[model samples]
Target: MHPMLNIAIRAVRQAGNIMTKYYEKMDSIESKQKGYHEFMTYVEKETRYQMIAIILKSYPQHTIITTDNNTMHTGDQHVQWIINALDGSINYIKRLPHFSISIAIRIKGRSEIAVVYDPIRNELFRAWRGHGTQLNGYRLRGGMVRDLEKAILSTNCSFKMNPNASPYIKIIEKIFTQCADFRRHGSVALDLAYIASGRIDGYLAINLAPCDFAAGELLIREAGGLVTDLTGSHDYFYNGNFVSGNVRIVKALLAHIRVK
Candidate 1:
């Protein structure tokens, strides 16, 4: 692992430890709503703080982007650390074991290192731009299934972000008819991680924040898959509408996705 990637692993593991502690006391953690289906907890705040603190200790000049808007710090350095200390707060609050911590380092607009840690599963998915993606320590080469009718697609649209359900619903309707089945695991970061690990063959979602998919996006690309917007563009970071999987399935999914 790269030194910075190793540091990220340590930082994420520290956050995971905090999460495990809170998992045993979910009833006491107070949470507030940010939107209809969006929420946060004191644990999320502390986790973000812990991650940034650990990261800044080594790269004090690097830019940091977390869910906390107040912690946004800009510097002359070219590296940026994007983090989501608690990726699935809703799931975590419900004592579901599907949440994760996402950490990624971008240099000059390119994601060079990425890590997604699922404490519940003890699965760490890591990737570097030119290097292959890994789960535990085994490298992934995407999924073996290429037929659209047999592929399992994953998404978060069922949660219905932004109340603009029409676009998402229409696109999903088309996908449901072709793909074997679909999954909504509540965590887009983990959904993308599943794609990298070949647990799922494809994934799509709209209105995703950069913190949610930045790391997993790199993981999918490094695992020999395609990551692109619904219109088949590489500008997923800007639009937050993305589809990713093995090249064949991604291409087929794009055909059924109506990019309104």
Candidate 2:
């Protein structure tokens, strides 16, 4: 195992433990706003402190880009750890079991390694840039469902973001009408991890951050899936909008999204 993978492994496990504690003690939890979401608490802050300590202690010079604390990074470090200390904060706050601790380390901004763990489920999903995706320790690869109509799809919807006032709803509504199934799980990392394990056929998300999809990108690709922005561009980390699946459905989904 790469040394950095060990670091990611430790950080996510520790974060998960901290989350479980908070998950069990909801009455004492506090809430704050981050972006349009009205939720955040001590667990998010404390776990980040712990993760940063672990990652920085191992590689003191490594920069971090994270959603928990919004610490901006600058300079030419070869390693960057993109972290979402609590990916499903709202679900976590509600005592739902879908939350996860997500970590993905980018080498010069291209995430080559990732770990997404859900302590409640004892699920640890990982992927190296070239190595195949893994669950616990088993290697994983995706299935080829050539036709989109037969494929199961997953996404995080934004009726609020669109508020019946945007054009994106039509795309997902069409997907709902055609696919074998469609699920709306609040956790982006887990949703992508499921795609890697062949538990789901494909996924797309609007406005995914670097941390949200970093670890997931590797898992999807390593699992014999391809990833690209809706425009078919390899600029997902910047564009923050992308699709992933067996090669057959990838383009069709992109076409459905009408990405250039």
Candidate 3:
């Protein structure tokens, strides 16, 4: 294992311990609203703090970026550690046991290593650039479905009085009619990880931060999957609209997702 990846695994496992602890005392936890339909809790903050401490202890000069916009720039800007301490805060708040911690290391603006740990299920998904994705030490090879009609797709859509809700709904309606089934899971990290693990055939989401899918993106790609925007372009990283699946399934999905 790479030294940096080892440190990341340690940091993520430590953060998982914090999550499991707070999960047991959910009633005593307090949360604050950060934005429209977004919540943050002490658990998320503390987990990030602990992970940062562990990481900086080894590489104090590396840049660290968190979902809360608290960026730590110590020295090197070429290497960035993007973190989402808690990916599914809504699920965690509601005791849904479907949240995860996502960590991705970008070296020279390229994703080099990634990790996504689910505390509730004790499942750790990881990938190192060219070295394929793994779940609990087992190699993953992504989904095998070659057509949307036989594929199980997952999505994360915001429908709470949003201006783009109409187009988003239209995209979903079109895809749902063609796919085998659709799931609206709360965590994009887990959804992508599931795609890498072949548990789900494809995924779609809109308006997401880099921390939400950075780690999982590498995982999917390493596991032999592709990630693209709804328009089948590579601009998902810029537009925050993501679609991912095996090659054929992704192309099939893109045909039905029309946005203007």
TM-score of 3: 0.92
lDDT for each residue of candidate 1 in 14-118, tens digit (9 for 90 to 100): 999988887776654333333313334667878888998899899889898886323476764589899999988888878888999999899998899999999
Clashing pairs in 3: none
Tell me each candidate's RMSD, in Å, in order.
3.2, 3.4, 3.0
Q: TM-score for all predictions?
A: 0.92, 0.89, 0.92
The residue pairs in collision within model 2 are: none
178 in model 3: Cα distance from truth in Å? 0.6
Q: Which stretches of candidate 3 lie over 4 Å from their true place?
A: 28-40, 68-70, 258-260
lDDT of 3 by residue, 130-207 (tens): 888999999999999888899999988854556768778878887888989998789999999999999999998988
Cα lDDT of candidate 2 equals: 0.80
lDDT of 1 at 219: 95
Candidates' C-alpha lDDT = 0.86, 0.80, 0.88
Across 1-260, the per-residue lDDT of candidate 2 in tens digits comes to 98999999999998888878766656543433332234346678888888888887788777888883355454346777889888887787677789888888878657788899988998999988877789999999787688988988888774565464255677777667767888777899998888888778888777778878888888888889988987888988887886888898887787777742
| Candidate that would win on lDDT | 3
Ranking by TM-score: 3, 1, 2
